[model samples]
Target: MLSPAGDDILIIMERLGPVQKKILLLFHGIAAIGLSYNPRQQIWILKQIGREWNKINQQALNRAIKSLYESKLIDIKESIDGATKITITQSGKTKSIEFKIDEMNIKKPKI
Candidate 1:
């Protein structure tokens, strides 16, 4: 059960879970590269990214994808090449920037 404002807040948050944030951040990294999608490659990126950064596993991968899609953070569709393509939406991109900018602002140690 949720109130009107609560539902509105959820709409703004897109109901993005923590795992969904990680997933969006991964797509954000890729979007930074100007190649938003690789029909040739797939969630291999997610698995590799999780392993590199957080040791997130396959179930997490699946759930993250599910959440992101449900939240409208990412779009999944077929490319002209007949492969699946996935990309972060503007909403996802903006949120990812918010997520990572703080990461970049961490104070450095004095030499």
Candidate 2:
């Protein structure tokens, strides 16, 4: 059972912008890659995704990350070495799955 605050966060997550959605999916992909190979090798540093995307500008990516963080979708942590790590929360995983399902299509056959 989710609290009212959690529900509110979920609503905010559902209304994420295109850049935010892409970031969520990127985090999802990183998790999937971890499971597929060595989990330890799947860490994503902050700004790395933006650099790899090569399309979304840095400011936009930063804004999306901040939004996602506020929505409680992703957790950002900084180590003593000052390396920032981004990990998707369970809520984020659910949202990413929703995005994938929303993109899936089934074609009907005309007999």
**Number of the top-ranking candidate, with TM-score as the measure:** 2
In candidate 2, what are the lDDT values of residues 1-111, reduced to their tens digit? 757865765687668998898888777766666575554545443245446577777899999999889888899999999999998888888788777643689899999
Tens digits of lDDT, candidate 1, 1-111: 657754653474656666677777766655544463665354565555656556567798788887778777789999788998888887767677666532667678999
- lDDT of all predictions, in order shown? 0.67, 0.77
lDDT of 2 at 111: 100
Candidate 1 deviant stretches above 4 angstroms? 1-14, 35-54, 79-82, 101-111
* Model 2 ranges with Cα > 4 A deviation: 1-10, 37-52, 106-111
Give the TM-score (vs. native) of candidate 2: 0.68
Clashing pairs in 1: none
